[model samples]
Target chain A: MSITPEERLNVAMTINGRRYRAGVEARKTLADFIREDAQLPGTKLGCEHGVCGSCTVLLDDLPARSCLTLAVQAEGRQIRTVESLADGQELNTLQRAFREQHGLQCGFCTAGFLMTATALLEENPAPTREDIVETVSGSLCRCTGYETIVAAIEQAAADGAEGNDDAKDGAQ
Target chain B: MKPPKFSYVAPTTLDDALKHLASDPDAKVLSGGQSLMPLLAMRLAAPSILVDLQHVPNLSDIEDRGDHIRIGARVTHREIERSALLADRLPILSAAASHIAHPQIRSRGTFGGSTAHADPSGEWPTILLALSATMQAVGPHGNRTIEADDFFVGPFTSTLRDDEILTHVSIPTTRTAWSFQEAAVKKGDYGLALIAATGTPRGGVLVDPRVTVGAAVGSVTRLVAVERILTDEPLTDELAEEAAVAAAESVKPISDIHGSSDYRRKLVASLVRRAVVELKNGA
Candidate 1:
């Protein structure tokens, strides 16, 4: 006889400053939970294997590979995906810089790169180019050769110094 | 595709975990799942039960007790990389660890999991072997300390019993001087070949050389001939190169797609030369 785990686990957590409760399976991946259950498709799933960082997300303010994490494992913890990157209509500095620098092409890897860069900048606002490269090393971008993406981050840093745009209040 | 369907259990305590493991004959303890998930997805391994250890909170901290460093089994590689304690106390481990798969893999993969998985090309076995670290295995029989030499038996294999869960790895802090060099084709893949040595240099002589060659054979092995040569003779440019040559000759490598046996042997010799040069240059 096969025994299944009790299916009703209260997954109460905050995301983008809004609280949510989800009935999660013990086996459901955090990526599936966020996309299918929470309806946030910004966190793309590619190479469900951990190698591709497309499913990168912030778990309690730290960058994590969400595909490998179990949804039940994240109960009562704060989760953030790419959808939380900007205000309702305004683009965050990184997003705006990405546009200005042509950091994206097809845009499949943008969300992962953005989330990772956001954490990197928050931790070290004055990071050098080497730091940016190392921080984004986990994420792969098949398009643009990563030059514009890196330039976009530098552009964002430069823009932040010039105070050309209002920075978002906190991480999404 | 999702991993093959299997039963999962997250135990609340270590004792409960042990009980569950002892009860199930085909149970696998899930650590970071960086290695295990790939195996499950490929259908290479299909254990009846996966005993998840995430709920057991104690296995996530790094403890420094001055004499040795006790790393909890579940501590992620990122934690060790960012820790000042590891950098200051055991920098060789950090160096080897920094080369592990990548930042995201390092962020999720646990130190104990790598060692327990016992991949010859992976960083943990070579690093711990260099440090002469100890493995603490917990099973229904209770905890027991196994020295690094005795822990790893062969490729993708360990001394761990079916019911045992690796709890911690204790690395002695005293006389912990070491150096590491790894060569790989990409930024984040298993090294093509690697050489790691730990010990002190005294009076122009390399003392207690714990030399081990990785990513060469199906499993890692200590190069005793090189260790003996370094111990008795002073390490010079000529002698170091000869030692590297000897180390390469010592391993019996097989021809695989990653590289040919002849190629790996040459690469191993070159890496050893670089590693010894690093040592001679005060690495």
Candidate 2:
């Protein structure tokens, strides 16, 4: 019923359509588990105290702070990181829109923005400017001002980012 | 920063979880981890064991009991925001839920967890106090219900015993018009001052007016002086101004980095006026 910090518990989860298993300490955060054990550094860790949204990932199809979530807590849950946003090397509609609209300059907070926007667009295929702003306001971005990021999301929604049904069916 | 060393236990049963909590004096119950994780990461709290309640059954349902709604402790903020029943019955909650952080935190943060965390700046405690909700807690011995007024004692402190787990909260459905107003630096940031007001408009008079202020003091406080001024009084601009002034004078808010005590008092007054006006306009 309990796993001490000294002991490692075998935790398995589906990440970006692939199942990954690792023996993680009870205190290991999902952000570290994904970046180190799963080797997907796309989910960035800015403020580990959950202030910054750089470490956001889709947990069970909803955006959650990976930094605040423990690996053991994510057991059996489906996770989608920023790495899952593209098809092979080509950028997805949302990513392409971000590039076109100059949504990122430093790109540290891009993953969290993309993940949070993905969930929003999927849930509400047509999100208003206010909706996009309301949802992404939690994720802080220092570069590109936030107008461009909001514009990018607006563009993605306009460009039919919701048309990608594959993303709707878990990670592809 | 990484969390300090600790043992983790995710018990599927409430009895087992209670047993684990009873056995360890230093154990902390892990609800949604939105608040606890921050404390852990900051090394503010170093519990020996974490009793995670994720796997527990019957802790995530939102049951409509006709006259009242019973929301389980593990009901996430996203769920509360999206629930059709809540939108129809408790629209104030759905509206307030959007103001609790961003989409990411709401997707994982539980209503019970937020209430149990009892942050002075938290929206749930303020809303619950306004609604006169009852919180259910289950311990090793049995279950007991604590009124929202008595549940919160101080900032980040609750009446919940270490061995007791908050099971659910029951809110009586009402036709009272409500308004939730708060001012934060950003959309998702913690509010500098928040107000939740509920009043039944009968004829031209506002009855049973409840004005609860949060995030500006040590605890979520209902401004009884403001409430007394508005109760059974005609909802008017002058009355709203009086209530606002009373609200501003009644509280000795803490001066924090987010806002000054004077600024927060002003915010409280403005927010109270705004909420009263909104309720007067039948918002």
Candidate 3:
């Protein structure tokens, strides 16, 4: 039996200090809500089965798979994405490290990894090699063997702790 | 993939939720949507009514009762991972939540949803089965408790009657001895084979262990012989090893895309050995 299309519900959420409200379909996913409705396409969709971390984003300072989350569920919540990390033309230290260390290839999984890493560093400042591995364990980068990604996060952690301004530019 | 059009209803009351579910047999209650979303996208599940339970108050709180902790089904995995009481009393649940699908999924996935989903391979059933936890479901009629053993009937299915909503999970506080172990091919996927064992007080072990082989086995089976062996016996490395193999003897694992049934059976034995050994070592 088919269900008649109900009137789209209104969902208002705050993403990166900006508030967005939309009339979304009942079945719309948070990932689609962000990309299609909010005009933020940086959150990549992969697998769509919740197995891949390519749809990762931050909900209330913690990383989550936006693809599996409902748009209505995110109402009145704080959602963050990779697009919010940069300030004007300046890049976040994690992005800089990813560049200098060559953390990404093809760039599909980069956004998810960046969001995951950002949450990791917040919860843990000086994480060890094992911690780094555990923090990013959910994300799968079919390229680079993830060694460079670890290095980038490590380097970024070091730079941020020391307040290294040049590292902010990501020149290493 | 866009889900099929459906009428959405976010009921604030438990009665309201039941009314919605009873109104339509096909209505699916959306909790965190971690499992439901994918089912919809794949066109495997097409429900005419969507009952959103996010706004239901008291459904998300974790109550640290003196003897037993009452965890709302909506309590997220992240909540479990961060709960100190859960770590102290129900460490196995916390440990299981920590291993589920990574931080992102953990942030939104619910304890009740996982249990109700009754995934043979998912961490919740194994942990609940090991702990012998009690699940309380509220429906249009009222509330009823279901034991872990009786809760799961098959893969992706539960014994919950139609129109019933699982409200909370109550776990014991007396038994402190617990051990858990899981092996997965890659990060965030279902376990290749996972085992959880808990030691009850009075030295009588509730060796109600669950052996779930994901992707390899189409379904999970309880190791009755192994449980009998462990029930009266003291947990030991040698005993555990024997029990592990014995548990394998009762299992009829099937080969799949993840691993062969033979390989999975072997892995189950090895993993169970490791988990029981840790319990003997008081880990």
Candidate 4:
């Protein structure tokens, strides 16, 4: 009996406004591809399974767990990571709010929260407190009990209400 | 954990996908991959080939037929939750869709995938059973449709053949008053016991009752005894309580870490009563 060879797929995707191409094994996850092939380590993989949202990234402007997504699946798709939020040197509104409010503790789950919040605020610039809580519910942050994080997102949304909602373009 | 090494194939047509599945008996269907991917990475399911259906046409469409809704296989749960047609036509299912795993899972999990996965505790299977939906599957041999009752076999098992792929589900027009209730540990966890009633108001009573409860033992079961009691009696608190007791006694629930068998029975009783009362008030 002969073992059939596993096929390697060619994956090309745009991440954080940069295009990168690679030939990945069929089993390679998008999280590994972004952190290794694309050399972007902002996306963290807390759980390879979909239960945890620490590896969340915007796949085509929607939050998806990169750990659960195959690299080949990202072909021709646009992905936004935590690196896309800042403009050269300026921290985005959500990041500023997080820092000002001490939304993060260990900062391990901050990227996922930020990305999920960015998607939420981009679609809903004036979200209520309940809406903000639901938006960030997917990502888990053991520290701070999500009180400060939810407040940060709410404040960011409120601040963006004054015509600084520039996170919309970052999502695209 | 990472997914085991496997060959990948993205087929744009249903025929191509079936051909691959027919050729490789160990090939697994990948739609949305919210559930399947997790299983794969957990090493619970390791297929030699993954047939990605992302490029398959017409699989993601939700068509509004006059009397039925032809939901394509790739329609995401989020789409169903946000669908205005479902909200207006199949309100029970729309309300039930909210109980599925959180927004991220809903964003990627597909209606067909969830139905095919056939978790005994799944909201989709329980809701589809309540609607008496039909499963549409196609293989290299041909196409076949299975009723929801015959589709689910056991925990994480379905009637689908390895060579077959579930294409779409046809949900018959639901113009009836309905109610859905469940008890889950968390907002998105599988329910310990789920109950849904689908019937119509006739002569000041909700008639033609079809009450189904899920996460009982293996598959969703219909509380025929409770349905009978509800049909023969007029709508009242006493009748509802009687039917609830009957529902709790009829089921054979199993003990799991999340709930005990006796606890599940009590849940069935309370949920059945709550659902009956809710439907009665609306009816």
Candidate 5:
């Protein structure tokens, strides 16, 4: 189990609108890549076993568990982390709703929920309340009873429908 | 937990994949990585050479053959869940896919890997068993197909050889009404027990009714006696209840932190009845 030329490889990806290149061990996960190598730490790791969807990120606009994804595998994919949510000082509708509606308490699982909800709303503009519940069920939150989170996502979906989503895609 | 260091080889062709598999004794096929990566992170199973099949061509397509749906090995659970054709021909695929550890896991978990992993508690094994799906595999030797009933060997194991790769799963499209049900404590947790049933009504009598139960034992088990009881008989709620009871008595469940052996048996029986009721309603 020693390293060979194949074991150490270089990979590059456009993460949060910026391209990054790194040569490292093939065993690194996308979660650690974005956190350590690329220096974006918004993607949290609650349970690295893919049980907890805390390391969720948008892989080509689909919510995917970064911890389960190898860094080398993401060489050519478009990745968006929670850091891509807000442009600068301004927050996305989802983040605004989460704050306004008290959707998070400990704030550990907020990024995952936000990222997952982002893709859910993007795919289906007007998802039913049941759809919201099903989408949020992917990310685990211990503090809130999930009612507030559901309401927050609902508010974001409603906001997105009002022609504000385009201007707010980049937040700032 | 970070995965241990290993050699990564991404092969774009099946021939190269087969060569790598045959050359390296420690090479492991990396499909969706929804299951393998977790094991790698936990340091439970370490393979020195990782043969990533993500770049393998034509392994993620879903082909709708005239009589059967041929699903590629790299087809993700999310793709299956979103397939409109699968919803009609085999609603069980989408129904079961939706419950597989949420959207993130489903987005990356492959249909073939889950079938190859052969976790007794998984949704695919039981559904495939009930559907009598064909497991297509390619190895250094040659290509072959394994019936779903004969594919799964034990928990987290299958009849696939070390160098063989599960290429596709061919599920013969059924005109029958099917239902899949599972009881889990949480939304993403593995179910305590699961039941998949398919029944076709022919002249007011059901024909070829099959029931497969999982998460109660080492591998998927078909309720043959229950299928025999339902075949050629006019289906009724009372008859479904009797079949459920027979299914309950059929499985030898083991206790786990999820549920007790008794609880799993009762759960499977109740799920069997509910699945049958749902199937009856669907028809």
Candidate 6:
């Protein structure tokens, strides 16, 4: 179906294992749709552009910049946000590691970092310190610098975060 | 920043997508949306329609065509980075793909989209130019192939017409020593200067060397003078120095907030020299 420039399109996406339906304008980004329409504010919008990784989410289990992805483009796709990293009330291994490692200060960039690290650990359950640094280098954090963030991801990998059935089932 | 208003369509067939593009002059083809998304967010581009290629079939394959590898337009950088076939046949492309942005950006950015974007600082364009890859494009008229050297016109510019969609890129499988070097303030940022060099290592001497530099000039350029100096010659410290000087002297770099023209020229020289030394050690 061709959506006109000024017309709103009906788009549906499953975010954090819940389906959300919204009639959004073609210009609305997936990030805004998640926060405003879907009522999922766990995803942050740091740089509306792709430079900052604040709007990163798992599009079909692959990390993508939600701010750059239009809501209409994500129709009928699976989206995993930071909210998917927990098991109901308990924080997952990655999130717990971030808290234990003091990986956040201002906490604005924590959501993006959590989502990015969650995807990384799932792909490479045992990533080296260098691999962790390389993967998280695109994300910027002015609060806790980067050492703590890298340590948190490394800790999560060491703790076998990928094998956590609770987090995995939560994502489903 | 939100994207400006635009109509959108996700055509499942290439023919349908091409027909939509042919019908509207102000329509933009959305590939991976890595580069175009930012432009739309900034309102730098407000196209009337966006022809999304996500559902388009047969545009995301990596095939071995006997003598060469044909990568589809929708192939993502992350896919290239993890492809076993590319690692076996063309490892240089894999190595260069790892240097683009970060894991998140690479996950969604497409190889064809990067080439179509034609940013001077883009790694795919420089690597394709070095390998002399062929770009396959399908337009309203018909299908055609373009040489990598002729594909790029300037920064963020290519010979691809608005009504055309890049379908695939074919790189000939050749055994050659190669090295890719770039200098950036941080990893994933645009490089101050980029260099990709390849040559046939015969005995202890190099032959048919191709040296391509990017991000320093208005467009990706091959340093023929430097290639001429290195061809059929044994690589040494003195030869590397000469090639470096020739590379730095050959191009007119553009000055920007990232770096000065003189600084980029120096970066080109250093990167060229390093690549030469690495190639000499049998890269």
Q: Best lDDT goes to which candidate? A: 2
Best by DockQ: 2
lDDT of 4 by residue, A3-117 (tens): 2226566789988877889978988999999999999998888888987788988888778888888888888988888888876788878889999989999988999888888
CA-lDDT, candidates in order:
0.79, 0.91, 0.79, 0.84, 0.84, 0.89
How many clashing pairs does model 5 include?
0
| Candidate 2 ranges beyond 4 A from true positions | A167-172
- Interface RMSD values for the candidates, listed in order? 3.6, 0.8, 4.2, 4.6, 3.5, 0.9
What is the lDDT, from 0 to 100, of the residue B266 in candidate 3?
A: 91
RMSD of each: 2.9, 1.5, 4.0, 2.5, 2.5, 1.5
lDDT, residue B283, model 6: 40
* DockQ of the two-chain complex in candidate 1: 0.38
The digit string of per-residue lDDT tens for model 6 on B1-283 reads: 8888888888999999999999889999998898999999888998999999999999999999988899999999999999999988888988898889988889889999999999999999999998888999999889999999899888889999999999999998764688899899988898889999987788888768889999888898898988999899989989999999999889789999999999999999999999899889874
- In model 6, residue pairs whose N, Cα or C atoms come closer than 3 Å (at least 3 residues apart or on different chains), thus clashing, are none
Which portions of model 3 miss their true places by more than 4 Å?
A: A1-6, A161-172, B201-220
Candidate 6 lDDT tens digits, A1-172: 7889777889998887788998998888999999999999989999899988988888888888899888988999888888877778888888889999999998988888887887888788998998888888878899887999999888888888883445356546
lDDT of 2 by residue, B134-217 (tens): 999998879999998899888888999989999999998774689999899988889999999997678877778788999999
Candidate 4 DockQ, CA atoms: 0.47
Q: What is the TM-score of each predicted model, taking all chains together? A: 0.93, 0.97, 0.92, 0.95, 0.95, 0.97
DockQ each candidate and list the results: 0.38, 0.89, 0.49, 0.47, 0.56, 0.85
State candidate 3's TM-score.
Answer: 0.92
Q: B83-129 in candidate 1: lDDT tens per residue?
A: 89889988887777778886667777899899999998988888788
Worst 10 residues of 6 chain A by lDDT: A163-172
Lowest-lDDT window of 10 residues in candidate 4 chain B?
B200-209
Please write out the lDDT profile of model 2 over residues A1-172, one tens digit for every residue: 5798799999999998789999999999999999999999899999999998999999988899999999999999899898888888999999999999999999999999999999899889899999998888889899777999999999999988973456547543
Could you tell me the lDDT of residue A109 within candidate 6?
A: 86
For candidate 3, lDDT tens digit of each residue in B49-162?
A: 888888788899888899888999999998998999888878877777778888888888898888888888888887777667799999887889998778877887788987
